[model samples]
Target: MKQWPFYCEQECEQYNVSSIYAPYLFDTSLLFFKAVSTALDLYGGNMSFYDIVTNGTLIAQCSVGELTGATDIKCCRHQMFVYNKTPVMGRTHDCYYNIGKKEMAYIRQLRMIDHENVNKLVGFCMDGPVLLSLWRYCSRGCLIEILTNDNLNINIDGFFIYSLIKDTVEGLYAIHRSPIEIHGNLSSKNCLVDERWQVKLSDYGFPFLKAYEQPKSSSEQLWTAPELLREPEAHPTKASDIYSLSIVMADLVNKNLSFENSDYNGGADEIIYLLKSKTSRLIRPVLEPVIEDFNIGFTHLIKDMWAEEPEQRPKIDVVRKIVKEMNVGKSKNLMDHMYSLLEDYAASLEQDIQGRTKELVEEKKKADILLSRLLPKAIAEKLKSGQQIQPEHFDLVTIFFSDVVSFTVLASKCSALQVINLMNGLYTIFDSVIDEHDVYKVETIGDAYLCVSGLPERNGNMHVKEIALMSLELLKKIPDFRIDHLPNEKIRIRIGMHTGSCVAGVVGLTMPRYCLFGDTVNTASRMESNGKPSHIHMSADANKLLTEKVGGFVTKSRGEVIIKGKGVMETYWLLGKQGEALLNVDE
Candidate 1:
């Protein structure tokens, strides 16, 4: 490697400059190297060096093993100068002295030009074998990494992809328009994505540095223009940069390496060989059929950019114009485009949540219907609200029990389905009558039906009136109900009523039942069992309450009937209500 001489001719004339300048320069270099080495050694290879002159600093000395993505590139932090203000990232490489000089020469030329999509050159450090070139740091990393990373949650829609292409074209056009008329080497790997996902062009205008760099693999050669690949001595021109741009655009769209879907299956080496061959057919990256959805204009633009002949390719400014037209009425920039997309996504998410909520409400309604049929509305509501239920006592209540006459005989005469139909039809009529009164149907066990009023929700003396009217209505409906299976057979129900205090509560957990307890319920059951079919039998308490308290019903006494398990008790046969019939009674 060549080193610049520290002493001039006039300084040599005035003093023993060789001895003084040589040792001083050599010692200064050695001392600087020793300081960096000590920092690295003390920290176990984690160290940073600050350049006092420019206020540029390297945060930590990155090792070859720590390098990600690329082998030759070491990403480090740097600042241009104290006056330059903002810090930036630097890509460092150990290159031959001649290559470093060549790159520095080109960089000096680029310092005057500026563009938004171009990575701004901060400064450079030529320390020993290390040649570091500083450029603005793009936190989001390179285009290739963004394209290939599966973990990155990027929305790569048409607008987003086109925005990147437009930015890339703008950068290229700026370079073409400047003194640095060409980016000899342009590729997806050289294009970077900033924090805002804006694509900025890098690794340009340093042909000498690129010359001594390791030969790219055949895969990487996919971005090289065919003319350059064919003619090794040809330098990269504006036309060649456009070709590379097309390859990068293809990678962005496909999210794959360039020419990944080419029909040529023999790998990158074979494709390169074919591309360089004079007689071989031209091969290009396969643009997916889906690309047509972006617009045919974009498709045609790419085709023209990478035309086989260098002269046939479009100019960077022409490409920029077309991209601008493509984006004219659209979002002004990438951030604006992303904001619009996010808003659309939020709207879609809200719609999905609303639809799901509506479905949930409908399912809850179905569950409520099933629960209401199992228990009273108040008890069901309490259970739904996660309230604990305890046994409740009613001071006075009317319990009613009823059963079909000769139900067992009728069931034996009919098929299982016919028996179900018979019961359903009979109960349908009874249910209609039950709905008219303020009573809760407790349960029905086979042929027996049980109901009560003023327990779960109290109605004072109205229980007697509600139960009397309910039982009378049930008896009236039963006489009119005919069994569907036995059309000629008349249906009859014997109903019994009792008025007394009782305890009611919900029981069990799996399939709960609201049950009434105490002698009142038993007495009511016995009254129905001991009475004749089609008759409304009432205990003395219920008869007294109905006649004296309610005063709407007429009754005849059935005195001193021996009740099961309760010795003899006075009972009465409820004949009929006021202005109603008392027909076919055994008086």
Candidate 2:
């Protein structure tokens, strides 16, 4: 057998006997040799030397001495006993006799030892020829024992499995987030189950002391990450720990030990070989099949953690978050019988979502139609989409208000049917002009038409341009009008435009209508009431956004004009028809 060296391989010529190791003055003395002997014995033959030192300190009062080998050592489990004494000691402790108390104190001060996840050191005391320390006990045994137990059977339900995975992840999260990385030995034995079957991570450290002496070449490379296994260049990292954890998860899912169901008596080489090759598939068959049978969302998550490239694994924090999302204890049975029920539930949910989406679309269409009829399609869309349709306050917006100028006179001369036909013909042309330039026709009062731009919704600089287009188009179509079954007659319409901001919103819940109220709206109405037939009166602010984009009308400032609600506003008159230029210019 190959010899493993200590952490510091330098040899010491002088051996120091621990003060705690002394012959008991008498068998009846509280500080007896027998108690010290038993404490040291329990630690001597242990799988982990670190566990020995710590556990010895807790159960027995003694100082620890270095152990070269078990031979010539008499500290056996049968000899250990607790003695009520001022001093304690061990006999036949030939390895080291007088280890200084100060050195043990120094070891306690190391930051790695102080970590909560690390095995805690209670205190060090002395007994005759023995040294002792304390540690937390795990009854279910180390991960090694659990994994090596061939007869071990675990039939944990799926929900319990989920919870265990989550708990393990949280434990790992704490370790990985600490200043130092804690690489858990990936085996079934280290994960100890308490009374309630809740898993508690035991063997709480990497045992740096043992690892230093353990040859890197001889270490089990199968549990290691690919990068670490392939070369000596890569040092251990948190991601490496994650890789080990994924393997543990695989074993739990399979309900088998992590050794690929090999016989328990196999040597380390045989176990390592099986683990690296065949055992690697344990996690796959267990995790993949289970998720495929239950929920497929997390199957990819399991695969990602076992990725050959360490960097591809999700960070510990992300893993915690993913595990937290899983619903544990939500399901009872783990058989294939629930498959049909789950499928039916999923189908029902999908159908519900589809129905809701369809209903929303139909509502949107109906709302859009109503909005288009009330305001223009363009303004309606802006409002429906919850865009900022600012009430421009005192800011000037061009308001275009128009009507059939000869409506009353025509009605008095013609029959009722003839009058109705004539009105429809004129309003249809007005509607076309409004649609063409994206202008909102506010409302009509008995053949009186009202439209505006840059008021309820700010058209910015384009307000006047739109009004100019609508005005020119309406004027052009007026002269060609002929009412069916009625004598041909020439009629002119007046349109007024003003630029200012006005308050606008949905009014009256009973018949919710988007209405504009403020000086801007009133002044706009006044412009049309005061304007002449075939003319478009616009405010100065309305012209700014136009930037002469339309060439049909000759525009000139009408100077300050007294208007209702607006004491006086600078207005403009759009004088008719540069037909070819107007048709060519894009609004």
* Candidate 2 stretches greater than 4 Å from native: 1-364, 375-394, 414-421, 455-457, 539-553, 556-572, 576-587
- Candidate 1 clashing pairs, residues 3+ apart or interchain: none
lDDT score for candidate 1 against the true structure: 0.77
**Candidate 1 Cα misplacement greater than 4 A, ranges:** 1-161, 171-244, 251-295, 308-318, 328-331, 337-374, 383-386, 406-409, 412-421, 445-447, 483-485, 507-519, 557-570, 583-587
Please give the distance, in angstroms, between residue 397's alpha carbon in candidate 1 and its true position after superposition.
1.9
Instruction: Output the worst ten-in-a-row residue range by lDDT, candidate 2.
Output: 16-25
lDDT agreement with native, every candidate: 0.77, 0.57
Which candidate tops TM-score?
Answer: 1
- Count clashing pairs, candidate 1: 0
